[model samples]
Target: RAVLAAAGGVAAGGLTIGTAALLGGTGKGREPGGSPPEGEAAAAASEEAGTRAIADPVRRAGHLLRRAGFGGTPGDIAEFASLTPVEAADRLVDFEDMDNSGLEERIARANFNLTRLRGGDGRPGMASDMRAWWLTRMAYTARPLEERMTLIWHGLLTSELGKLGIPRTKFMLIQNELFRRMALPRYDDLLKAISRDPAMMVYLDTIQSSAAHPNENYARELMELFSMGVGNYTEQDVREAARAFTGWRLTAPPRVQLPEGASEAERRAAQDAAAEAYEPEFIIQPRLQDRGMKTFLGKTGPFGGDDIIDIIMSHDAPSRFIPVRLFREFVHANPGPETVAWLAEVWNGSGHDIREVVRAILKSAEFNSEAAYRAKIKSPVEFVVGAVRGLELETDFRATLRFWGPMGQTLFQPPNVAGWPGGPAWLASATLFARLNFLDAFLFPRGRPLRVEALLAREDAAGMVDEALRRLVDGVMSEGARAALVAHAESIRDPVERAATVAYLVLASPEYQLA
Candidate 1:
């Protein structure tokens, strides 16, 4: 419950619990917090003014939760709806003081150890196991934004469990934790850390890099994808930058090769010993490093990996590039020049502070506009995580992995270094059906009773449909969607079955797929 003082233009204690009153659909109203909500006439008078600026608390809260984190629960929405935009942004972005012992305890209780591999192409179901572990955190963590930012980094910085291999899976977890700890870190610091990060080193071939033959893989991606975007840096710059990062390698985890003719028990013992002895860490071999002056991005004088990152930060390209990508991730797929310019200003002014840039985007009028609401399709991860949180369901993360792959997203296994194509790419014919089938299974597993008794306060069909829509879709279902849901609910005479059916349909609806 530790809170920072409100930052930026929003005033303190300026919002009230008007969401309940608004969602009740009674036109009769007085503005909350003793300030009148901006009327449409006033809104019409200015480009920035709108009903969403200080009114439409529910939609505003939904937008925040959907983008800032995964979609939230009704309780999450209601609580967030009570805060002004800046206050809500503050609660999410400034989470350094928050106690996350509950999430830690849950993870401990699960006892998911990554080191235990089941053999063959690394570990069987290890990627799924990892996905489940993180999904649990996303569903139950106190700091949703932290988990959301971790996912964002995972997608953007891009690593694959398949590429990292099972023996090195622990390094992927290490990278994940790094993103969480520095979720709102300065851009320069994060780049510097990731450049030397053990998992990243292995994933991008930095481990194989040497002065004799500098591997340009990491260097190319560092400039083209990670920092300056494609085409901003030349092939020569990539070559020089690769030299700067030469000799970056990780400690070799011991591989136990059982002696021929050894008994099964003896082989097991050796494998166990190697597993226990393994310790992965980053190491720079001076002998393998290039010491001679190397020109990179027009700078010369024995630049190292850290120096290359520092030089990238010194340029405006990183400042412009990162904020724009972040804007698309959080706001909409397409960003106009004006939007980019505004966010870039925040980036520069805040010294490339991620939190400041994110806060600015969340608080901007663009984020709350109709153009951004449900504008992007839900990536499979978001859809699944949102469903679990929306229903307040307890789950075995392992079970979820089966559905995730067919539904077009498998955690820790992005298709390439560029990561998940996201947005409209998630809605292919086969994948869309997979999404529907997964929801059907999730809502009514094995045709058994639904697990949402705690979520339903009413038993009748109409009441149940309303509750489902309210809880799952931020109560923003269209009239046709509502009518369709109610019809489906009424078809089932049994109240629980009816409620579950309604929930399933809403989840399967096109509206739910958007966020």
Candidate 2:
């Protein structure tokens, strides 16, 4: 259902990204931005723990969708509600195919997306523009679970060309290829793809890695960021692994203007010739490599790049780390511990099968339990993007890219290698202001199928706060929180004020921001 907009885009009065908010969501004025006291948090935890005592699939599906993929559309929730763990697993791939139907086309379109010189991020848009695309896709996707998995894997198996001063076109090509081909494949296959990627080579300094001047950057990340995680591998291991990845490089994207009726053989030959013939192409300089024995995660033997990947993947750490991450991502952080121990068993048993681990998590009592739903805070990326999708504000996603910039994320530009500290970091006063204001950007005052106020009216207002709470939260809100929202709405006389007040309360509420 690719509906091309006629000439001028969706009208201004209807659902749209509010572009003129001179007062953007910004600042770090949060009232002590950190996790709440244990006692209060634990009580809330217990209440959520209480919700899990029943068999509520819609609730469970919603719980899973919020963290697993993006936000759940009504249809997505219903679809999730109709699945068994195996059925859910089958559904995931089906959804992936559908989501990526126009993916290549969309990527092509994004290349031509008009932009108005957004600051100096090298990327366009105000915030992380891609996140906006991701949010809507998730909101619209039939397979929310797969989206979540892709995101988790992306963080672990990272890539970026801009960070390496590589050409942008090639970088985009690599990104599209990664998601299109390996996103849903086995984690092992995904690792192999990452190892060969031009973007990964540059971003991790692997291209500079050599037989003489060994760059340990990519090697360290494979152990620290990708697989075993921190403290499991040593600096010596990084050095050894760097040597293993010697000779990894890339040919830049082509600048060919093919002649008409080029033969298939001629065209392919041209491509191969282009790759092999390009001058000043990106290439691995292996003179710096240190060929030596490096004991990584207690595996000591002569190792090369493939040997390094084998050692890392065959170890206990990646399998364990994966489930713990999946648990952290799809469920709550403090997942009964026992739940993880069991899931880890399955993950290891299945050769670190991501879908297997995810299926296990989805079926576990812990996942369906109350404690898991509203356990974590939404990353700034999730909050702002979710706001745009929730309001169905479709436009050139540049607005979202712009909005995300101030909130502290730029597409392909993370704050550092460690990535954004998601939870309390997003709750900072300055960052929180930017997040809440993101919703205000979508609220239009006039036209058909209106904006914020119209959204409030269509929803049952008696259940307005409840609906907002459900859309924003993973679990039930406290009585006090509910009362507060209703009270705020009642205090307002104007419909616009009422709607905006309700929205503010919902977004400001503890439930909305937490994952």
Candidate 3:
């Protein structure tokens, strides 16, 4: 285990393990209001609140895991706290949580499935039904981060919807393999995998690329979007790199559907559209790849696709890009130079060991400090799921849909693949309204998977609310937050329901949005 030096933060390991601690009940000694947690801000707030910050380790670990991976149920969070940040992260990066079925099983069940067909459209074979179901099933799967990584990679390497001909099936294949399998691997491997994916080939028009007619889009993105942050690669590099990828179109044949009932005219129109969508494939006249030596960022390549990949991955710029994004995720959006410099050094030195980048951030002073806890404004995806996690909502298929659908988020369906704009993009008055509605909908999760009310009744309302707050917000709510919730509970008759209601209020609060 390669380790980075921790300067006054986490030890060599991220976990601080011991016998698991039991969460306190709402015995009279349990404070009703949530004061700030201990550390810098807590020390300051203590002056005004007249109470010390309570160190709720479980809540702290829960906050860390949610931002690092998917939100955890209360029990899951407790177990998570027992593991150091590295151990917990190992489970996440290894995709250990995603053992629903073997890859072969995943491939077999989805092999011949068709997603959509308008009954009377008379298209030869309909597939919209199969595609929608695929997306929906992925949404409900327990491994949200793996899926989330696939979604991110898809945005970065977007394919056109219409041109994929059998877009639905091909899309599922790329998602299941490239992104899911390589989600936690080194960035170099992921970039090459994207270059090989049939869906990406079609989407980026690379499949049509030939020695004579090179496709530059894939090459341009290889530097501009994927590896080096934009502006590091030149027009000269883009032109030469495109030459490297000639003759790399999709190896798989297009799935031609013959939906019944359509006239010849309708089929012709569809075929025309498909042809246009796939024109690059059939027409990439062969061109000679640049055999003369070329250079990209100081590395010369008498290059083929492999040489181009070698040059691209060896660049220092990507070292900065990968960790900067990772820091924004594990830490917060604006990681100061000190943090990025430290993380970038680790990434570059470790040959882009992704786990190293994650470990450094998790153990850094920032991750555990009071300011870092609950600092990110949860995106719609996190907010919805985190609320369900806090309430221990038993979620099923439709229940999962309600999480992102109501908030105008559709994961892989983000408008135009630049990815649903993160941070401010998630906020709008309308979206905020949807967020509130979504939280209330939780206690009554659509599929009714878990009887949330029954669970809450087992514990009094205020106490359960406190537990929910500890898990969701990392126990950072203000004293005013608790009082406001308690006041809201006064109107409800049953203590359990009132407690659940209060949990809803805290989960819905704006504070939960931050890291």
> TM-score of predicted model 2?
0.73
- Per-residue C-alpha lDDT of model 2 across residues 106-223, encoded as one tens digit per residue: 5455553222212134654322344445554544444555555555655556664347542232353445446645555667777777777766776777777667667878888878
What is the per-residue lDDT of model 1 for residues 1-515, given as tens digits with 9 covering 90 to 100?
00101111112453211232222211112222122235774344333332234358887788789888888888899999999887998998888787989888988887665555543353444445677888898888889889999999998888887887765676787788899888988988999888878778888999999999999999999888899987678899999999999988877768789778999988976876575467777788999999889887788888999999988888879877999999899877667787788988899999999989988888887777655666567788788888888877777566566787788788778899998988667866678768777876777788775757744567777888777777766676545446656665677777767666666666666556666
Where is the poorest 10-residue window by lDDT in model 1? 1-10
Once superposed on the true structure, which residue ranges of model 2 sit more than 4 Å away at CA? 1-54, 82-90, 93-136, 160-162, 169-173, 252-302, 335-337, 388-393, 444-450, 453-467, 474-501
lDDT of each: 0.75, 0.57, 0.57
Query: Which candidate achieves the best lDDT against the true structure?
Result: 1
| Candidate 3 C-alpha lDDT tens digits along 1-515 | 00111111113443111111111111112333333244666445423322222246675577566766557676677877787665765666556556656433543554433423232354223334333344544434555556556555655656545556543343544444567667667777777777777666766777767666778888887777677878788898888888877766443334457689988988866754453343222222234434556665666766777678778777778877878877776655667677778877988887887656766766666665544554455577667656655565543324345456557675445565344566655655567667766665655445232345533654554566566566666565546555555555566676646665666566555456554
Error of 3 at 353 (Å): 2.5
Where is model 1 more than 4 Å wrong at Cα?
Answer: 1-54, 119-125, 255-260, 263-269, 272-276
TM-score of each: 0.87, 0.73, 0.73
Worst 10 residues of 2 by lDDT: 21-30
